[model samples]
Target chain A: MKNWSEKTLKRIWKGILVAVLLLIVFTFSPWVLVKGKIDPILFSMPYHLWVSILSTILLVVFTGIGGMVFYHLKLKTDPNANL
Target chain B: MTQYLLLIGVLYVGVLFFLSLRSRKEIKTSSDFMLGGAKIGLILGFMTFAATLFSTFTLMGMPDFSRNNGVGAWIFLAFSDAVMVFFILWFGFYLRKRVGSESFGGMSRLLQNCYQNKGVGYLYFIAVFLFLVPYVAIQIRGVAIFLIEAFPDFIPVWAWSVFIVVVMLLYSELGGLKAIIYADFMQGTLLLIVVWLVAMNCLDNVGGWSALFEQTANTQPDLLSPPGPKGLLSPQFLIASCIAIAMIPVTQPQLSTRLVIMKDYAALRRMAVAVGFFAILIIIPTVIIGLYGALQYADASTSSFLGSVLLREQHPAIAAVTIIGLFAAAMSTSDSQLFAMGNEFRGLIGSKGENNLTPIRIAIFVFAAAALLFSLVSSNELVLLARLSFSGTGIMGPMIILGILAKKPQGSFMIGLSAVALVIFIVSQLGWIPQQIFNMRLDLLLMILLSLGALINYYVKK
Candidate 1:
């Protein structure tokens, strides 16, 4: 068995960083600004309202999916032989 | 209707009493009392976490917020909660790694070990204590105000508040966190079921989702956007809220303790994801209820709007069940917090050893009583008061983050810096200092400075 290499750890941090930045952009940036400004009705709701509702659902699903995969990979690649 | 409320209330209280009795066997030692013997499996772990986080704030405070602020409430809570849960996966792992599996009284004790300075523990507890009191008070206050509104002819506000604290003290002093966890599971399920039932009815009454949104958009489209109609949920405010709430798992001892008590990282991971979905599930119904208010009670007062939606809008029988659910939500959240304070009080009063559990129990009762009194005197702006609590505790987040991520002893510089920042925050709140610097919120500014201070200390010392 091998220890968790620094390269692997760095990759994990990089993945987290990207996820954080993308979340920030989608939530706080012009993406929300432009879309949230559009009051056009969509699916019985305004565009901004739909964005808030749909975007939240998307975030939950994305995180749930992302976390499950992360757990799987980490378990498979755990450095501890007995784990 | 009155009889129904009493029956359901009695049944719920009976169940809690039974759970407390059952848990007595598991809580012989201090560790067992504090962390449920560190054996909470997936369902209990997830529900307890969700229940503690979702609170009267969700059951009562949020629907009122969304009713007034419009759809921005989603951004305020749901989005931030989603982000928080994602962060939880990594943060939970880091916290468990540094703190170990033993229940070390509370968060302050863990920090005391990490920084090797007792002052850090004191300062951290002081920061959290200052925030947790009003935070718990609002939970009591939120439900108390609503209970009076629901049963106005009966209980006065303060009486309702005191009743809850007494109930909280009873179960908590009996079985401690173990009792609170089981109680939380019951409360969480009640909260989810009752809110959804009321929300579906609200939807049906408001002519469903399409009519509710169409009515709000046609009558007041401003209710659907950034600042909302009341101008409370601005982009900057929402952004600051996201930051404060996202830091909750780090700064809030009740939640951090839950992280340590989970069976393992696998349980924690599943708990985190479950919480994310729970956040959506919980907040979605509140938004629907809020929109229903927009349609039916557009110009009503907050109390009136909440009463109509939570009580008057439902059948009398369902309204009775909903009241019990609201009481359960507030009690579950407050019990965790007051117990966390007790844990902190224990650690602060005796860091050298664990010889006096009696003092902690007394402290818990005192804390619960204090929250009841504070509920009488506190502001009625539930979400704002809650955000204040978040930001106050959040100023201490960088130190905890630094501790969790650091590979070696991080020293006391971060501690001193955070202590000074916490002092500034309290002073600012008391009107002794400007609440904002450079046109930015003082709490947000403190967070940036604290994080920078942590980085500098890390680089220089290690």
Candidate 2:
């Protein structure tokens, strides 16, 4: 059962990694950057700036989530793992 | 202001010496000196990592970068850092696991063992030394310039630079890595506090967040958007920067050593997450401060603008603390890089150098002296020089990743590829070759080719 759970976590991590790469690529894309578009501001920030901030925050959240899953998987697979 | 600066500066130096002396008692072996005994917990691990990664570049360069380039500086640094911390989770695990069975040394030594070739280690050392010296120098140069601007005719910039290098060397040589880590914790906290206080003051002066952006729009709407006023933050440039910055953990020895020294995998992972949040927290203030610079000192010279805003405009007490904070910022990062390079040299020289800290100590002094000389001649383009350092060392990302992740380690070709790419990048930076080829940046293209090369090597060997 532990092995099975570990496998599931590993799969989730792989998925998260893919999602993160996509998010990063999209954040750097023309759609998000949209040169000279300062409209649709939030809290007085320009479009690209706010979007970039949001993207950074989202990436941090993903990092937190990814780290938790990674920790559990490592604990399971390498029981004698050097700390 | 001078009195406050003198008081706080003396106190700060006293604390640094106390920490160094205390750490000296813990040093019984080379590992204790070089790797801080490799038993770091989450808080110290994250703070040292954060402090080392975000140095004078973040504190001094970012505000000026944003003031000139606009909000895209966020994407340039903070966004890049967010990706970097996540990369750490993956890379750090593989690295720690690989080194788990072996006695850990610097990355140069580890790569030598990984590839069973001395050339791999030599290539890495040369690449890192060529790039990191200037990176370390700029830390000295940035603070030295700021101090000169803050106090005219008090001391020459070169003298200030020498003073910083001497103080940093004295403590680091005495206490070793443990002392550096403790100092980093203090510097990191001080950095966070100082930047936010200054940013809050800047924000208040410019009204709130909304009004600040409005005034910036009026001053230079280009500062409010992408490509910026100078078009320096174009998508291609930012994308390239993101790749370079994200590769920092994989390529930069100072950070890579921190990854290896964490007490456990759990601590390493937690450190990564904490660093991510820390990156966001540290960078946001620089943005506010940058936009503030835009409102007031947009056209002033870099030193002039920073002095007026970071020193002259603030309360005397606050200004004094800011000066100390900047000084601490420079030392926290420079000392680590200098020490890491010394450790790398020790790694290459074998156990003779390791068993006796004397040789390593001398190497550290030599490296510091070289950096001081470089600092004297280096430009004031702090952010760009830093990025170039990242990009130059970053070209080794594929070589290092292959070294770390390979199962059988038959990727000797990467050494030559990285060297060739490093040379070409340097030549282009020197303007012997065009910076862009077929409308793509040369550095970006080289990175793509190297990654592909590593991928092909991995599959073929597997």
Which candidate leads the pack in lDDT?
2
Docking class of predicted structure 2: medium
Per-residue CA lDDT of model 1 for B1-462, tens digit only, reads 788898998998899989988888776666677667776788999999999998888888888888888888888999999889888877876787776645567788778777777888888887887788889999899888888888887978888888878887888878768888999999999999999999999989878888888787778778777678767676777887888999999999999988888887778888888998888888889988988887788888877888888888788889999999988898888889987887777777764326557778877787777777788999778888899999999999999988777777798788888888988989999999997788887877888789899889888877
**Predicted candidate 2 versus true structure: per-residue lDDT over B1-462, tens digit per residue:** 989999998999999999999999999998789888878899999999999998999999999999999999999999999999999988998899778866577899999988889999988898898889889998999999999988899999999999999988888988989999999999999999999999998988889888898998887898888888898998899999999999999888999999988888888888888998898999999999999998899789999988988898899999999999999999999999988998898898998876888888888888899899999999998999999999999999998899878878765788888889999999999999999999999989999999999998888888
Per-candidate DockQ vs. reference:
0.42, 0.73
| Candidate 1: pairs in clash | none
| Candidate 2 runs further than 4 Å off | A1-4, A78-83
lDDT of 1 at B430: 93
lDDT of 1: 0.81
List native contact recovery per candidate, as a fraction of 1.
0.41, 0.78
The alpha-carbon lDDT assigned to residue A75 of candidate 2 equals 80
